[model samples]
Each structure stands twice: as C-alpha cells, then as structure tokens.
Target: MDDPYKLHATAMPLEQRRAALTALAGKIRSGGTELGWQVTWNVDYGDFTWLIGGHINNIGDPFDDNEFSSETKAVERAVLDYFAELWGIPPPHDPQDRNSYWGFLLTMGASEGNIYGLWNARDYFLGKDLLLPEHSSGDGVEPREPVLLYSVESHYSVGKTAHVLLLETPADVGARRYPGQCPIEGEWPQGVPATGGGSGPGTIDVHALRALVEFFAARHHPVIVVLNAGTTFKGACDDIAAVNEILAECYSATTGPSWQTRPGNGGRPDRRSWYWIHVDGALGAAYLPFFAMAPERADLESGIPVPAFDFAVPGVCSMVVSAHKWIGSPWPGGVYLTRNRYRMRPPPFPEYVGSADTMLAGSRNGQTAVVMWDFLARNSYETQTTEAVTALRLARYTEAKLTALQHNSDHVPDLWVGRSPWSLSIRFRRPAQDIVDEFGLSGMRVQVQGADRAYVHLYIMRDTPRDRIDALIRRLAEPGAF
Candidate 1:
C-alpha cells in the first residue's frame, strides 16, 4: 500500500498540474504587460497556431527539392519572393538566366544569416575560382586575403562570425608587442581608431570606411563591407549609398571601361563590382521598405531620407535580415538573400535528402517559416507601413519627451539623446537598477572619445504604446530619482 501509489504517482495529478500551469501562464501574461525591450517583435500566430503540431522540418534548400518536408517549401518560397521584391532583386525571367535572386529561411536568427552571407562573399572573392578578371596583375600570383570592413557599432555577431570563420582575430594586437608575430588564435591587431559624427555610436563614418577600403584595395586584397542598417546599440544606419559611391571611387578606379566589359559572350554584367556590401539589416530591413518608394520609381525621388541598403545599391552583394526582430516571428529565424550567381556551391548531392545541402543548417525549422508567412500574409505593405509610421512617430515623441526632461529636470540634466533621425532607439544616462529591472531595460557602457559613459536604451517597437513611454518618462523625471 505504501509503494503502490508512491512509485506510480510521484508527481501531481493532471488537474493539479493544469492548475499550476494556469498560475504560470498568469504570471507570464502579467510580465508580458511590462515588456519594454525595443528589439522584441512578438506576434499573434492565430490560425497558423496549428502548425506547431508534429515534426515539421525544412531539410535541404527551400527553393530546391525537399526530401524531408515538402509542404512548407511553397510558403517559404512566397516569403522569399516577397522579400526579393522588397530588396530590389530582379524577378526571374527565363529559367536559363541567373538574373533572379536566391535565398532561404535561416533557423538561427541573424547570426546564422550573417555567417552564411560572409561565407558566400569569402568564397566568391577568395575561393580558388576567379569570377572576374583581375584589374591588377595576378596571372600566377595569389590574391591577398579578403579584408572585412565594418564600423565599431556593428553587431557583436559580425566579430564573432569573423573569428569563427578564421577571417580575422578580435582585439588582438599581433605585431606591436612582439616583432613579426601573428595573432595566437585568429585575433587581428587593433581595429581602426573610432571617429566622431556617424562613427560615434551608431552609424558608420563613410569617410573612415572609404579610407579602410582603400587601404585594403591598395594592397590587392578584396574587401567585404558590412553595412549596418539600424545598429544594435544605438539604432544607427550606415550610409549605404555613400558606401557604394566610395566603392566605385576606391576599389574600381584602377580598371578601365573594358575592365567590366570583358568579352563574355553573353549579355551579363561585366565584373565591375570588385568588392561586396552586405547590409546587416536585422532591424531596419523590414521597416525601411515601407518608407521607400515603390520599386518602379527608378529616379528614387521619394524625398524620404531613408538610406538604400538593398539591390538598388549596385555594389551590394547580399543582405541579412532577422524576421524575429521587426517581422515578429515566434522563434529566432531570418532571411539571407544573395544574387543567384553568387551562391556558393552546395554540398555534394545527398542521396537520402535528394537535394544539395546549400543552407547553413541541415534540419531547418519549417514551423518558423509558416509563422513568418502567416505574419507577412496577414500584414500587407499598407498595414506594415501604418505600423512603421506609428513606431517611428512614437520614437520621435519619446525623444522629444526625453529632451524636454533633460532640459527641465534638475536631478537628470543630461538625461537622453537620440541617434539619427531615422533611428528608433533613444539612449540616455542609466537610471536606478530597480527601474531598469522593473521595466526590462537594456544597458551598455560605451567609450565616447575619451570618456566612458553608461547609458540605457529603449527601442520603440510596434507594440510599445505612448502611455508606456509617458510612464517611463515620468518615472525618469521624478525628483531625487537617481
């Protein structure tokens, strides 16, 4: 009698367990009400909630054969086609042409997309095969190792990807202390000195970027430029158009007209593009397209100051965007887009899968694709535009409130400052740790010029209401509230 019930029912019964789960759900919902993170993009999956049942795996390429799971591929393609149009990748005409774009749903958020995009660029430029005839002399000599150019404000994932790919060492000063020394563990020497203006905390300084690219191109090394579209910390966006112009001036100056028009018997583009520009638009990619002019408007006279980080920029080779950021998917997933010609050779035919292993991960998340598709399908451009407008409006409103507080509040004189006009993050001096914990605020310590300053960031995402901002501002302005 003592053993019969004890061993079989060590845990609570179903009724009791359900009650505990209900309690947990109430707590989570209460916590969700206080959600303050600007990077969090939560969505209501509604009808698509049924997709969570069973094992849904998107093995192999999304556009190619999917031996494991084929049901989600069509939905995934619709997602890609929508983004391709948004990013300015030309639609495929005839099946024989490589004019269309190629991409896949990434399972591991933007980090995976970043690595995949960089890997493609590395292989395209530094791989054994040469796509374009060199502008410089290189008949028998090997090309210099490709150099990665990104602002100090770029996401940490960029640096991590570089290290993981053995591209460069992070924060390692190789030859300074010891003469003729290489980094011990894939660490590069110190990076370029940080400058002010766009180079400060968010955006990239185009002049500094140009100088770095020229420094590398002068030595015959191909360059990969990671342009930030809405940086992680301060929500800064690099000048993609300016960067493109700099590429034309810095990297391609040595070549003549025929340098790009190598007599390829076909009517394809010549190899004028010497370097690659990958837009890390984890936050802004989904948001900017709403403000941009319709793709048919070639003159680009939209009057919107939005920076072009898409195919409209001739030098841009690829872009990585996180659906989990602004697009509001359930899980961490993203989209990686590149030209059809620039895609790396996939692994040899996997007989079992009946498709080449082109994507970064083998067993992809088909459910994430469906979630994204549901979100995208329900929200048209008009709906997204309305939401984008509201978010930015609230962001500006929050900044104005903060600025007023900085001017009036005695306890906090220099309270808040906004980044670029297009940014959504409003950074200010850090408040008490209790408030930070209460509101779920994110903090960072950054070095500006010579001084180290602590700042708290608030990202004004879609769901963030005006009342929430007002409440935070009021709490921040309260007297004796350090």
Candidate 2:
C-alpha cells in the first residue's frame, strides 16, 4: 500500500476543516439569536427570516440593476437619482451631490441602515459644533436643540440614537419618539413651534396635527417628522398620501383652528417651519411597492403602482429598508436611501469614533453588500409582487382551511380559528391546549395559539402549496384530534 490513508484523504487538512466547521457552527448559533428576535414581533419569525439563496430569482430581492453591462452603474445612478427625488430633495441636492451606490457605505443590517439615515439627518441638519453638550466645542459652545419625531410604535433605535447624541461625539442625533395615542386620553400633541408648548397631547392625530400646524403657522417648530412605512407589530402603514395633503394645507395657511386654546383667547402658529419624513420601513417598506394592502379586495395588481414616498415624495428626506427580513437575505443587510446628502449627519457620541457621515459601521463586511447587490440585480417588482401575493394567497388559503377545520368545531370542545398575512388579525376560541398539541403530535411543530385568547398563529408565505394547505386543514379536522 502506497500511503493509502493520505492518498485516500487527498491530503486534506483536518485542522483547516475543523476550524471552518467551528466558525460555521458559531455563525448558526448567532443567527438563531437574530431569528428569535423576529423583528421584535417574535411569533411568526419562522415564516420569513433566513430563507436561503438557492434560486437565481426571488421576490425578496430588487438588486437586478447589475445585469446591464452597458449601463450597470448608470442604472444604479439613475435609480439613486430617482430615489433622491423620491426623498424630496431638489436636483443636485441630497445624495445626488455625491456618488452613493459606488462609494456607498453598505450596512450589515437594517439597524445599521436606520443608523445611517439617522446620522445623515442629524449631521446635515444639525452640524458638529454642538454635537456634545458637555464637551467644550473647542470654541466653548452650548449644545443645540436635538430632536426627531416618530411614533411610539417605532423601533427602540430612536431612543438609542438619543442616548448617543447626549455624548460629545460628532455623530450623535437626539431622537424623540411620539406616542401614537394619548397617554391620558388618546389625544395629539399641541404646540406652535417656537412657543415650544404642547398644543395638545403630543400624539399623532390627523385633525390635531392640522390644528397644530395652524396654531403654530406664524412660524412652527423646526423638527424632523419621521414617518414609519411599516410598523413592527401590526404592519400597518400611516397614510402617506393623506400626510402629504396635511403638510400642503398646513404650510399654505398659518392660521387654523386649535384644540389647544380658543381663537378668542388668541395664540397664533409660527410659519417659518419645515420638516422631512424619514421612512422606517425596516420590516414593512420593502414589501410595500410590490404587495397589495388588501389582495382580497383591492383593484391593485400583484404590484400596484404606489405613490413615490421615498425622497421622490416632496417632503420625504430619507428612507430605510431592511434586506434581511422581507428581502430574504441571510441574517443581515440593509439599504438607506436619502435625498439630501449634505444633510446627512451623525450624532455626537464617544461610541462613534469615525466619519460622522456613515452610520453605525465605518467599514462593513463586503459580502453582505455583494449579496444585496446581487439580489437587487436579479429581481423585479412583478416577480416580487407575484410572490408576495402568492404568500398572501397562501395565508388566505390557510384561513379557509382553519375555517373548514373548525366548521363543526362547536361540538369539538377545544377547537379554534386563526388568520394571517398582516391583513387582519383574527382568532377563534377553544378551551384547552389539547388541539394545540395536535400539531406537534402529528410531526408539524406549531405552538398553541398565543395572544389572541390562545388561538394558534399562522403567517402563511408565498411558496406554500395548496395541497399542503389542504392536508393541514385535514389534519386539524381529524376526527377526535381536538
């Protein structure tokens, strides 16, 4: 035998193999941590968090601009410019002033993407001189008023940004998250800007907002109006078109009715004001352009044309979209699109030691960007929309199955109904967890109904097949399974 063992093993190094495998295992475990988060909603994290990259086509991607050799970068440039417009920056303003997609700072995840936009908005709008309140400005200056307005439904990062801004770092941007409803009685905030007084409840109310705009129209508070494209829990969108309408009306006339003080008592709104909409679509925005809000009843197609609410929208200044969750990317990746590149600002913080422009990460792993770019280069709105619609249909189909499974459930004693696809939250009642155990006993692992009075949860996806759906229904309705 001539070195049988070595020759058979092809002289591969076991040490190298061991090292690679160890690294991979650690990655898998870390991935679980993120997967478990499930966008802070925790439950349906299974339906769409780390879906792989086996095929060349996926609705979860929109990076298809890479295929054009004749104008690959050109296409991206055009797209960037389009986004610049979408974010409401005039020509030669925002990111258009500098090249982004190429010299771009790609993020490792959506949080980083949000951070990136936050940095820009903070820095470009506020400047480094007053970044730190405690630190001498090198010229001895006091800190400027730092604030960003968002809803309570907003992710926790806004508060994190505020923490960073309290420091002396130049990248800090203080953020203020507005409670969606009133703390006392579900009312909105009231103030006339420069007056700096609460006009109302400081909450988000359409009519209340109109009143505040009027009350402070003489010159309003100069603040950033950060809007959420998709909230984490409910996945509902704040009306953009209507918001635009509100802004237009408020700015046009400084005087309007106020719920704060009577017109007879007489306090007027300041009008010197303006603001921007920073879209936090970390979980929901990516799917917006392509998915129908209500496939069961809308005249929309697989991907209905939506109002360009990106920078393209008149007042929209920036946008953040997560690639990992809905994009189906592995673990991490996100993109921050902005209109005013110069306006991009970083919060002053000791934690931030690098360029005030790039958010969170000064240097990110290139692999994520490669994957993100690849996804965008190979997918289209139609494909993505169709896939999302398919997912929605799957969800609808699952609902029907649940309906059938519980058709005669009145006699079953512990049977229930369920719903999904972010359309509507629905549930049915059951007395015991025995029916819940039925799924696990049948080898299809599923948790007992949660939150909704103990009804099983489902987040049916686009790829689920009809036959499988039918089988699931059959199993649930199995004689005595309840």
True-structure RMSD, every candidate: 6.1, 12.6
Q: Residue-wise lDDT of candidate 1 within 1-482, one digit each (tens)? A: 33322324477688766776787777655544443454453456677756776778788877676556545888888888888888898654222345568888888888898999988777766552332323332222234566777777788888888888766422332233334433222234334333463326567766656655665555556677888788887887778898888877875564321133222323333343467889999988989888663442232222446777898887888898887778776678888888765665565778888767877888888887787788787888888877877787788788788899888866786764755657788888888887787777788887765677778788888787788788888888887656
Write model 2 residue lDDT over 1-482, tens digit each, in one string.
44323334465478866776787777564432221122221123343223232222111112323331322233333443433432444333233333232123244565665665666556533433211122111221212333455555456675566456542111122113333422222344322121111111112445544544343333433345556665443343555566666766764564332211111112221111244466776755665556543344254323434434454455665677765666555556555665322332233532332223233553344334444455555666567677666655665655665666566555544444533124322234432355444321111122332332333343333333467456545655655654
What candidate 1 gets wrong by more than 4 Å, as runs, is: 1-36, 40-42, 92-96, 129-142, 169-201, 255-273, 293-304
Q: How does residue 40 of candidate 2 score in lDDT?
A: 22
Worst lDDT window (10 residues) for model 2? 192-201
Error of 2 at 161 (Å): 3.3
For model 2, the superposed segments whose C-alpha errors exceed 4 Å read 1-106, 124-147, 166-219, 255-273, 291-308, 345-359, 400-408, 411-482
Model 1 scores a TM of 0.84
RMSD of 1: 6.1
Best by TM-score: 1
